[model samples]
Target: MKCINNEFLSADTYKLLKLAKAKAKDINYKYAWVHKGMVYMKKNDDSSKIIIRIEDDPTCMSSNLKFLSLNVNSYTAHTASFELLVTETKPHIISVVETWLNPEISVSLNDYSAIRRDRGFTDESGRYVRGGGVLCFIHKSLKSKVLFISESNHINHPEFIIADVTLSTGSHMLISCIYRRPQGDLLDKFFLEFGKLYPHYNNVLIMGDLNCNLLKSDRASNHLKSFIDDSALFCVPFGSTFHTLETDSWLDVIILVSKDKLVNFSKSKPPFIDGHDFLICEYKLGSQNHYNKVVKFRDFRNCNHQALSQTLNERLRLTDIDPEMIDLDELVYFFLYQVTTSLNIYAPMSERKICRPKCPWITRELKLEFHERDALYKRYKRTGCQNLFSLYKIKRKELKIKLMKVRNDYLKSFLENESNGSNIWTKLRRVGIVKSKQSSPLDHFDADQLNKFYANILKKHLSCSRDFILNLPHLYSKKVNFEFNWSKIDIVDVTKNLQLTLQKSSGKNPDRLDLKWLKDHIPQVSLFLNLIFNRSLETGSFPEAWKSTKVMILGSNRKLKSLANIVLPQIIIDGNLIPYVNTTKHLGVHLSANLSWDFHISQFLRRLFTEEDPEIRRSDRLAAKNNISFKMPNFATTTYEHSFVVTAIRLWKDLPPEIVNVLSLETFKVKLFDFLISNE
Candidate 1:
């Protein structure tokens, strides 16, 4: 067991080494290693070499020897009152041994061990003596040989000790030891004396029992606050050193370093203890060879209260004893599961109902029956489809029905009382009706009187505008396609040759179609075209192939002619066209045009003769001549009219032999027109 424990500790140490290396690489620092009692050094790509052995007294020799041997380094055992030497050329690791004689006599390396020693002074009664002291070691590389020490003697205050040392390389280290008063007025005097002596050193660490919790503020806490305010010194991270077991207060402190000089330092939680707790302050020295490390808990065996509790909990969890026969904590765990399951089973279906059943005795009996049913179901291996699940589902449905019945009964009661003043008004308000005042005899009117009053009001405001009446015929006639002279055509461009061919062959004038007409009629054409394209896009049929059979573009209107031009190109460009053409036909023509044009023109013309506006009347006369002069020629009569009507008719006609023999419409139309005119 001891060997296994040692192996575990070694594994932990290896993990720490890996963590340190990762941290060093992240921060761009050069060297990092574990420092046993014997120091190890590696410089400039060379293997590690043993540099020095820190001497430990007889008290710490056993653990120190074990640590050094496990780490595989050589060390010389010695006892001396001198400090170790560290240089700036490469990173150096130092290990120190010190005795701890506090609430418990434990190793100084353990973070939870409190080093308590008394001062020479005695209390007023002389029954108790103050003679406790703490031993601290300073680790740093210095430049000079001589060390400076300062002490303060203040009234009713603990003495303040400050030490400054410079090594052979001229780098410096300063250490401050403060012994504070146990109680009363002496604490204030100690802080004032310490403040007076603080400013003279750089790279200082003030560590000792100051008898104050820096983590919290209290009436007695002002002394530490004042000391920090007056001195240039600052506390490091992991600020709390002493933790009270009873109150869980962090009282005793070890403040270290002038804040600006210390860098790359982190803290960890103090170890658990029975009576008192302690924190460790770990830091590095120098600018270039700064160490990356931890100030962690070392010996924590003395505090066993929390540890014992944890052990007890674990034992209880693993034991086979019945929960009902066990202690309160174990019983709580068992009962909580029962209550959670019961609540989950009922809560969803009981929205506004009381949690308890309407009849208390029934609820108790039902609960007892449920337990029996659950036990039987579990025994039968029918946990899912058996008694408990079926009962829960039935209970939910019954509760929903009860709730609905209550709601319907309440609404029925409200509607029955509807004749009283309040009830009548309320009923009217509910149905969104407003009540008016009762009329006097003089204000009463018969049907004839009402009709005459309405007529007078209507005649007073009614006046027809000339444009509204006279323009009605043109608006109405606009819906019907009247033939126009094909000679009036202009703005023809061959770049849109397909569109031009479709328009000319259909005998529709493209120049007369404006943007407004196109905007209004395009959607209808687009919708039909979308239906045709959707089929082609899905079935892999070309738009022109569909156009040959299912869809037909037949209209004398110029807008409809322009729409055919617009939709055909859009279909080809969007890749919705099918490759093969179907010569056989299936469907009749689907007309895409405005139905509103049929009615609007007739209404405007009827309003013209009765309208009052003279200016509108004159404009109406001009629009009628210019817009309505186009006549619809009879296809069966005159030869010119026959040619014009034939052009419109041929769009829907089957290809004849003469037309099929021609290469293009220009070739066919020129020959047909000469033949028709010469024969006439």
Candidate 2:
């Protein structure tokens, strides 16, 4: 964006200029773009700058109710054509087989998540082989968990991926994308393992280039019919999906097993270059979640905990029945109600609406260009006009190249400036490379089935009886006189234990009442607890409510898992190799082998003193023999301790006493500041 002539502008500079350009056409000069130290008209150079506007929910998000299956010969090569297709159709789930991709090559689509199992093979004879990979692209509106089974040494396994997807409306679909070699193999073993990966009752959607041409009578189709349950329906329309000069075979297929009937099925030429056509089929799905874009959270930044605490105290004091006389559960309920009630009145849930346009870089003008190009392609196809076909090809090529550039520019600036609640890790997740387990949504199961699964898991523990322990032989002890009176227990001890509990509440599920509010009214809560405990002791029965706790399961791992270099077993600490039960945390930072924030902090301090004329304020505490003093500013809270004024003053105060004392610039400012802060 060289404003001198608007020529010879670099890609990044042009992108940065567009970030500052006007969103709408206006004569009042509200927005302007700067380039090469000069301001210019914010209009796009070639076309009208058409902004991509998004609603609370986009039409494409709801319009996509179909699943598209294609046989992409080489995904890496056909990415350009495939991306344009995604932009147009916006299918909910896209399945690809024969990607001819390895683990090194990654495929990604914006707003759609990719689950892939690249072809794995060994070339022992110095030979090369290709053409077997399975991939599924699920929209971000759905939640997907992938289960990949690694290749086994003894068997030539089929390339397949099981992706359990939960729709926005909470309904689940188990999509399995598979790719089999055209050559015949043992279908029994492959199907057996595939069945074991997913539950039997799952609403299954099986799609891929199975190499089973239904045109001719074949055993492969029969095997599929037998394996898929009675409810299973073959959705691929009768046609030659794959075409050649001499022969056309219906190799690509889709088999769905669900109670709901199929809504529609249609076929279209793949946006990519392939012999196989796209098999697009739509199924009835549950309602889309309207509130998905509205994020909910509590805005605690402006809340006053002290006032909330006082209100809770007043409510607790006004309870109709005395806590000491009421049942223990009743007392506990009343106490929790008062605290949570006050908190809700102070700080409540707030929502921020997020509008993410599917293709923000593809402005209205670009969309028109696409339509015009498509029209040219149709006209050329209808007629035998070489010139028209050539023009269409040229336009298509230009649009593809422009799309890649515009998308890159828009995303680069969007990621930098957009305040959407996403972070670096979220962006990484979008790449779909991180190997970790995610909870699979319930596939074709009801609430009772889920409850039964958990029940079966906990049956052994819950069914354990006390009869054996009661009848077991035990050593008898001499009777000892001990005073067991809860009435004499000091309220301070109760408050201390309660405060300790609150302090350890970190990493646990958030409670209804904020810990700040609870800690604020420690005495009042302690009084209620003390009364319940003393009464429980007198009655010799603990309230069931006291034993209640929340449990969140992060995947089942009762059996040991192999770390293999993915994680370290032991670490050298204090000249010893000590084994740890789990990862260790320091403050709010995760300590890793490569680096941590501590390393960066140390580097900052080192450069501050070691480098001449450094950017930082230059007095280091460890660099001098005695602490120095300087003009200091007092911070009201620890939140401001790292601010420039505070850190600069603290470092300046660390200078030598003689230099600090003799200085006319507020001699002994640290002491004066400390006195003033203490008095305040």
Candidate 3:
């Protein structure tokens, strides 16, 4: 039997191992069941009546308030690894520096909402200075509100992102994620900015990769020390060596005010996604949010469908129908109530935990490989052996390859299963596979420029010209060959069609209603839609809500516009000419005005648009020429692969001709998009 020492294991694993060893001895067992880095030793042979209890380990306990900070050199390559760590660790808040994220590439995680201040702001010359960004990821359950900071107030602006947090305990915490470049006078300016903000928050946490070596008693270090002294901030001592990388110097640091407010401050091994180690801390500031399990009356696999139909029929018979007409809203509400009540009576409510599932791709082999890689890294760090370091690097590369394979396998299986009609959508909702965006380079225009550009677009495309509108009556009187029957649109058929087209799980619409809720109450919604259509036909007018238009801006060379102007002679939304953007999402396929795929490429090659960055280009050249052994940033790697165009075309080709040819443009846009996106 092989014996593993506690030195190589994590604190939690060590405690579990000790308990397992004792239990195995008590049961006189020669071996223990080891699976996925956990030891499952039976206490007795009678498995059914076995005594199962272990002492509570503080290291294994979940923290009410947890924070993780990492100096990710570039987040593009390591987003999957970072998400895995965050999911497993279950941190409440995460701070990342040197993110190198841009508007084109989205790094948003499922359970986490991102607040990113990316680098590469274009100057007057339309050139970019690309390399420093700060970002933060807060769990959606935290209910954290980000406070906007005015960057113009500071004369010397260092890269930083600050957020004011109101914890569950009702305590206030100010978190600042910063990145200080090791250049001229920037560190001094950072210290000044820090001093100015330190006095504002009572419980402040300052985390960053401040490139100054604290071990060296230099002027910058001394100044940092002076600021720490003045601000009454306590710099937590690293439990291990201060160095995070192979440089033998410490760069990453964490400083916080109020020692009593924090606990369990420690550093993790290098995550292998980046060169820097992850700093983890837990602060008991506020009460934990009470996650009350919502009781939903969902149909189970063995639900009595026959009984449900019979009960609904009997209930409908019991109701006395009036000969006179009722209000449209009342009729719709009563129909929904009947359907919902019948379903609830047939299928009782069940309490399900609102927990995100683990990544389906994370296999036991992957866990063992990750553990082995971390062990090798620790050994190399301890012994400083060239051979050990070489082996570690090899293992690191192999681990990356393994991760890519697992992700690819997962994606392949997911798409295949979903295409063949599988209930894998529930898991897909929790861990949606993030794909790199594929499109042409967006335009670089300021807010004023974009407003002007979109105003013109709206006028040309959306609004009718004066001459065209004046001639509309003449054209309208000349009836076309097309004819329609409003009565043929059965309410039940429309309801079923809408329900079939809905996404399994997605965010709320502008009306603040989820697809699932709409599906369950589709009859009422369909009746309401029927009433609205009839009313529109009778009065030749649409509802105010239906008239509101939300514009989505896409295409090449687009800037991050705050607001778009729309001024037309005949356009009005909600009794106003200037309509606001209701909802904006970043994902689409581009087509020319003539509906030709001429400009669109099959592959979303990230390298195509990024070739202009000198830093990235230079790094890639150096790595190729010298066969660099160190970890390269995301930009240095030339392995960008995406088959979005191929998959999309294949899916579209698979659709039946009858369905494809008959679907209207608006219907295809909403329903086809939902189907493709949900499957993806």
TM-score of each: 0.25, 0.34, 0.32
Q: How many Å off is the CA of 136 in candidate 3?
A: 0.6
Residues 1-680, candidate 3, lDDT per residue (tens digit)?
22334344544465567676776677675444445556565534554322223333322433346778887778886778787877777777788887877667677787677887777566668755556778888766455665543253231356777777765445567777777766424455555655666667777877777766677778767777777887788876653323444555566777778677677777776444445678888775543444344544465556676666566555554236541264434543555566667666766456776544457788898899999989998998678998999999999998899898988988787777675233455455446544234332123334344344444443443422335423333332211122222343467766766776684445334332234633544543565455544544433333333322332233233322421343312323223233222222221222322222221221122322234453333333332343432232232122211223233334656665543664465666576666667778
Best by lDDT: 2
Residue 369, candidate 2: C-alpha displacement in angstroms: 56
Where model 2 places Cα greater than 4 Å from the true spot, the runs are: 1-60, 125-128, 153-156, 197-202, 229-231, 258-261, 269-274, 288-680
**What digit string (tens of lDDT, one per residue) describes model 2 on residues 1-680?**
22223454433344434533443344433345444533355344554433332222222233336788888788887888788877776678899887877766777888888888776564788443566777789877677887554464232566777767876445677777877767646356657766675565346687887777777767876665566644345554647788887888887788776536477787775423567888888776656444335666666777887777677667877355765567767776776777666767887668988644245578899999999999998898679799999999999999999999998887677567755454444543443324335432233444344434443443333321234322221212112112212243567878888777674524223234455545656776777667666666554445544532211111112211322333432333223332322111111111232221121112222232244443223222211212333321221111122234334444445544554444353545566576557667
Ranking by TM-score: 2, 3, 1
Where in model 3 is the C-alpha error above 4 Å? Answer: 1-63, 123-127, 148-157, 187-200, 239-246, 270-274, 286-680
- lDDT per prediction? 0.36, 0.57, 0.56
Q: Please give the distance, in angstroms, between residue 602's alpha carbon in candidate 3 and its true position after superposition.
A: 99
Q: Report the CA-based lDDT of candidate 2 relative to the real structure.
A: 0.57
C-alpha lDDT of candidate 1 relative to the true structure:
0.36
Q: Pick the TM-score winner.
A: 2
What is the total number of backbone clashes in candidate 1?
A: 33
- Tell how far residue 554 is off in model 3, in angstroms: 86
